[model samples]
Every structure is written in C-alpha cells, then in structure tokens.
Target: MTNSAANDDGELSLRWSGRVSLTPRILAVNIFALALLAGGFFYLDSYRSRIVDSRVAQASSEARLIAEALRSVEPDRRDALMLRLAGDTGARLRLYDETGKLLADTRALGLRNMVLRDPDKQGRGQAAARFLDAMIDTVVGAARPPLYRERADGFAWPDVRTARSGNLIAATVWRAPDRTPVITAAAAVAGQGVVMTTANATDITQTVRVERFRLSVVLLIVSLVSILLSLFLARTIVRPLRRLARAAVRVRLGRAREVVVPRLPSRRDEIGMLARALSDMSLGLRARIDATEAFAADVTHEMKNPLASLRSAVESLSMVKDPDLQTRLLGIVRDDVHRLDRLITDISEASRLDAQLSRAKFEPVDVGTMIAGLLAQREARGVERGIRLRYDHREGERMTVMAEGARLERVFENLVDNAVSFSPDGGVISISATREQEMLRIRVEDEGPGVPEEAREQVFSRFQSLRPEAEEFGKHSGLGLAIARTIVEGHQGDISVESREDRVRGARFVVRLPLADRQ
Candidate 1:
C-alpha cells in the first residue's frame, strides 16, 4: 500500500520541487510598503521639529527685544513708558524692592496695593553687581564697574535690575491699567533698579498654529500621494509576476507546449528586467522540450525496426522447437513483444502528445452526454468480465464544455479502463457527472481495494505502479494515468484520484473541464 496525496491543510504546495515559490516576492512588496510608510512619518517628524524650533526662537527673540526697549526709558518718563508699553503689548508690568517685596504692579496700583516692593534687597544687589562686572569684562576687556547695595527695603524697584559702583539701586517704575495678561521681558538697568517690558505671546502662538496647520495639510497631501504611488508601483511589479506564475503552473501540469510571455514596456526598470529574464527562461525551456521530443522520436523509430525483426526471429524459433520447449520460448517471445510494444507505445504517445498539443482544436461538447457514452462502452466490457457498471448524472442534462472531443474521449477511456482493471469480479464501477459554476466535473469510481494514501499520486507518473503481491499478477505499464492527465490538461482540464484506506478498497478519479456558454 502506498500513501495517497493529501491537501487538507488548505495550502497550495507546489508539486514541481525544482521551482521556487512566490513568498519572497510577497515579502519584498510588504517591505517596500513599510519603507514608504516610514518615509512619510520621518518627513512629518522633521517638519514638526522645524516648526517647533522656529516658534521657540521667535518667542525668545521677541522677549529680548522688549527687554531692551524698556531699559532705555528715562527714570522720569519710566511710568509713562511702562503704561504705553503695557497697553501696546497687552502685558503686565511689576517692580519689586531689593527685599523681595513687590514694589509696583501695573494692575495692582490701580487697586491701591502700596506700590509693590521687594524684600530680598541684598540678594538682588549682589546678583546685579556680578552680572554687570561680567558684561563689562566681556565688552571692555576689563571689569569697569561693581554695583551692590543692601538697603532698608521699603522702596519700590523695577522688575529689571542692574549694577552701579558696588550697589544695586532700587526705584519705582510706572504701572499700566490693563486686564489682559502678557508675557514679560526684563533687563537690568546700570544705575537704576531694573527695566521691564511686556508683550503679547498670543499672536506668536497663533501664527505658529496657522503655520503648523498649513504644513500639516501639505504633508498630508504629499503623504497620501506617496502612498497611492507606492500602491501603484506594487501592483505594477506584482501583476507581471502573477501572470508568470499562472504560466508556470500551466507548464508544470504539462498543459503548455510553449509559453510566450508578452513584452513589458516597464522592463527598462528592475521589474522589467525580471520579466525579460522569465521570458528568456520560458523560451529556453520550450527549446529544450522540442529538442527532447525530437530525440525521443528518432530513438523510438530507430529501435522499432530491430525490435520487429527480433520478434519475428523468436516466433520462427518457437515453430521449430519441441512442444514443451516451444511453449517456453513462445512465452519469452510474447513477454519481449509486450515489453517492446509498451515501450514504443509510451514513447510514441508522449512524443505525439507533446507535438500536437500546441495545435489541438477545441470546441464545446456536452459533458453529461460524453460521460454517458463512455459508461455505455465500459458496461459492455464490464459484462464480459462479470463486473457491473453503474452511472449517475447528478448535473442536469447537457453540461457543455470547450475541449477537443477526441482527446477528451481518450482521457475518459483511460480513466474508465484504469477503474475497470482494478475492479473485482461482481464489483461495481460507477460513473458520475456534475457541473459547478464555470466547470464540468466527471468522476469514475471502482469498488476494489482502494489505493494507499501515498501511492495515489505516484500512480499517475509514467511507468509508476504498485508492486504486484502475487507473482502471477503482472504489473501494469503504468503510463495510462499519466497519459490521461496529459490529455485532460491539454483540454484545459485537471484529473486527480481520491481513495479512502491504504488497501485498494475503492478509487475515484475526477476530471474537471471548463464549461462553455451556449449561444
């Protein structure tokens, strides 16, 4: 018993072991898609970073400019300047005394809050003096001033502080009457306490938002276009491969005598190069097949004449020998003749099928009628062998298909003969026909010991057969199923075997052919 073929996993396993699968192509497409996605994300990230940096720089520079403007105001005009600056910029202004007490607040002064003063006078004075000395040293190549002073801290001081002669002075600055909050900028004044200005950050933030929105829209459009183009490219690359895959399958099934792939214009690119390579490979394969067929035909023709002469000589020897010896010699001759006949027949059929396939005529024939006729013919042969033949047409009458009638009939005869040969005496052989969508199916089943699970597939290969258990039951030529499969495929159909147990209990051979629409 041999193991039968099984595809219970719902995966398409390639039968031709030498060919590579398309998994790598699929992986490459996915990889390219991921690259596109990553590129889009990277572009957006870089754009957002630039927008953030620009916003931050603008904010910092605006703060510095406001602080500088406030520092140049005169002490007498400081109050007026603060009011004007606060009103113009929509910001708050505050002055503190050296003691960390609030000295003045633009908004609070209106509410009579004792002109806010600072309490940390000594700390502010020391910090101011140090900063001034650093600035002088940087500008003049020498420290030109030291300003620090600790005072009884009731005086109002500006929010900005500066150094003068080892003292940090404190002074009252103007206040503004405004309800809107603002971003404040401060600078230390040299002799005066501090100068501060305020400006609205709202406009800057709004501008940033507008710029971000515009950039986002542009980025989104570009990303979308990029994705679409990537999809187009993926499809472009995959389409030719898909066609090549189908052509490969046809070649594997022995359906195609020659494969002619269409030229690709896009072959100037990498995918185009791949397509050209595949086309070249297909042409080479066709040429090799042609050469092999010619070789087989020449060899078979050369051997046939010698084989015929050998058989004739053996027959002559049998006629001149003793009865018992003659019988033995005749048996040997018969075996040789049968062997030669089978060899020549298989080689001839293989070569002819290979040659005629490219030009075989195809037309519509009723599948149900064809099966009925085959069953009728088989029934006549079965009756002589004490076997009963049964047939069932499950599909309604006149299931039509587009195929060559003679080739299809040969396929049918081969399957029926295979079933009949395996069927036991008093056993039944059944024929069935059905249609499903675009295909017509025919099945022949024999009640015998079913083929083993493993042997079912090998049974369809040339010269492959089960080993004979009893010495008397000679092994079959084994090319019947292979030839039948070839014929069925030439008609654009498929043939496969189904069996249950390891023993030859029963075997069902199924044939599927494309249905043709009736006018």
Candidate 2:
C-alpha cells in the first residue's frame, strides 16, 4: 500500500510538472529565488531600527548633560545655556517642573533649534517618501512606533513621565507625521525638574530607501539575464528533443521513409548524444521495415512456384490415362509438396533467427572441438558415393569463441552441407579451423565449380541458389547459406566466399568470429 501510494504521488507530480513547459518552469524557479533574496535585502527594517536606537542613546546622553548643566546654573543663566546647547546639538531643549508644569523652551529663548512638520503640509516628494517608507516597513514586517505628538501636560509623554517618577533618564522613538523617526529622551534633574531632548533622524529612512532601490536594480538586471539564459538552454535542449519526437511520431505512423531525424553532430552534450542515437535508431528501423517488405514479396514469389506446380499436377492427374505418366505426375506432385514444406520451414526459421539470437545466451564454444565433432558425426553416417570429409586443426590448440553453441553448430552444418552439394562424388571436402590474430577463422573448400566474383555476395541472400547442374530441381531450399550468414553475423562475425587460395578449381567459404577472452 505504501509503495502504491508513493507511485501514485510520483505519477501525479510528473503530470503536474508536465503541464508547465521547461522554459516557464526554469524562469519561475529563478524568479522565486530572486524574490527570496529581495526579501532578505528588505531586512533594512532592522537596519532602520538600529539607526533609531543609536539616535535615542545620543538624545539620552545629551539630556543628562543638559540637566546637569541646568542644575549648576542660576535661573536666568539656565535659559541662555539651554538655548546654546539646543543650537549646538540641533535638538529642542525644554525644562519641565516636577508637578508636570511646562517651564522653559529652546524656541522661547529664541534659538529655534528643531521643528516637527506635518506631512499633509509638505510637498509631493515628502508624500512619495512616506509611501515608500510604509511599503518597506510592511514588506519587512517592521514594528510600528506610535506617532509623535505634543501634549498639554509634558508629563503625559511616556519618557517624560518615567524620567520624573524614577529620577532617571528615559528614551523613546516615535514615527513623525512624515514617517521619519523622532527620538526623544528625558532626564530628571536632582534639585530641579525634568530635561527633555528631541531630534528628527531623517537620514535613517533615506539610507534604507537607497539600499532598497539599489537591490531592486540588481534584481531587475539578474532577472533579465536569467530569463535569457533559460531561453538559450531551452533552445539547445528542448528544440532538438522536440524534433526527434516529431520524427518518431511520423515513423510510427508508417511515414518512416519520409521522416528525417536530426543528428546534432556539432554538440557534444547529452542532448547531442540523444539526437544522434535517435537518428541512428530511426535509420535502423527504416531499414528493417524495408527488409521485411522485401522478404514478404520474396516469400510470396517462392511459395507460388511450388503451389502452382502442385495445382497443375493435381489437375493433370485426372486427365491422364496411362499409369506411367500418372505415376510421374504423382511423383511431381509429391516433390512439390515436400518442396513447399521445406521452404515454409526454412522461411520460418530465417524470419525468427534474428529475434532468437538477440535473446540467446552465449558461452565459450571451442571452434576446433565443435568442427571435429560435427565431422565425426558426418563420417559416422558415411557420405554418398565414397565422398570424404576432411577436418584440419591443431590437436591441443584452443580456438574458443563466445557464441550460442547450437546456433554456431547450425552455421557450420549449413556450410558443410552446401559444400557437399557442390562437391563431386568421392571428392575430398576440406574443412579447416585456425586462429588468425584476434579472430578464429574456419574455411570450407569444395572440389567443384566456384562461385563467380560478382555473384558471391548474392549467393547469401534469401532464396538465392547456385546449385550444381547435376542436382535435381527443388533439392535445396537455397536459404542455408543465408541463414548461416545471419547466424555468423549475430555472433559478431562475417562470412564470404571466394576462389580457393590453393589454385584449386573450387569455392572456399570463410567464417571468422572474434576469439573469446581467456581471462
């Protein structure tokens, strides 16, 4: 059950993935990764917070220093000191009583150090900055600080209340009406009231926005490059594969002769390998189909001869009155029947030979031993008219090859039988096996007519015959050498016939197979 479910899940994933073509999938994955990187860059939110914290610390220190100065100064001199400190620090300085009553301000002292502006009263640029700040904050999920506002009671300020009650400095950061940070700090004077400092840190927002803008530019450039590379990759891989697929479909639809599968010869990648392999496969399949058609036509031609002979003999038997002629006609009828049977049997074997050899398991076959054994059997059954078979090989030498033993034996059997059919009665049919470099060579020589140079190759084709003039018609099916050649080639070997090298007036059939690895 678990395996089945896993298989189902795997198939479902394949189906889902197949819905989206390769180019889009590649683009989507790259864009998603870029989005993640952009999200990480947006961490400028924490960067802004750190900048505000630093400003708050500076404000707190300034408040403490101003409170100490106010404590030592006389009442009238304190206002001038506050005004000077506010002008130098670029912060508004204020003094409040312990009872939360407002006392003195930097503006009241004619310093006019800092002013908090309302965003609604600013220009379009400020509005755009505020909008960008909100977007950045939302993207990074930054904490939202309360808006900065003035209160009638100074003690109502959180930092101010804390400073007065605890007799210690307290700082707080607030968002201004323009979305910039406002840092405020309050310090309690020992013998006096509270000292407060406020500053607007606009540089923090500017810094974060600049970083985000730079990141956006980088992301845009990378996305464009990634998309182009994806398209290039898809063109190199997907286009060739699609061409191969369309060719295959055409081939499957019986248009193989017309389809030309592309062979990407210039590329050295796996896709190139696939294209070449498909091209080769299509060529091989097309050849096989053509051969099958030709073979069917040949089979029809071969069978029709015997069938027509049989039909004529049967029809003539009824019209003839003489016993001798009737007996001759009956003999002709029998011959035709036997000939047809033999032809059918040979045709079936030839048709199935390739398929069988493909599935055949091979073992080490000693060519010398196999040939000797075959000759021994033929000799035991005595050749007609004192005909003799001769075997030649080194007694103790190994001539092993990798092959299906039975099929290899059949190849030799056919060769020997073919030689016997051409050899004169009482003549020696020479058989020899020898090692030739990395191959095992066997030759069957007959003392009779030799095959013509031009007809040598044709003799191995299906239903081709080059029989002796003395041999009766239909004595041989003519598929022996053809089947033998097929079997030999299946074992990674070759077969050919030529005039005997010894200057004899006969033909020599040579079979060469790769020698088996001894180690």
TM-score attained by model 1 = 0.42
Candidate topping TM-score: 2
Candidate lDDT values, in order: 0.59, 0.88
Candidate 1, superposed: residue stretches over 4 Å from native? 1-280, 283-321, 381-384, 394-396, 467-476, 500-504
**For residues 282-358, could you state the per-residue lDDT of candidate 1 as single tens digits?**
78788777867765655556556547756776867846757877776677667667666766776678658855876
Best by lDDT: 2
| Backbone collisions counted per model | 43, 0
Model 2 earns a TM-score of 0.93
Model 2, 160-221: lDDT tens digits are 89998885899999888888888899999887889898888777778877887788788889
lDDT of 2 at 269: 89
lDDT for 218 (candidate 1): 67
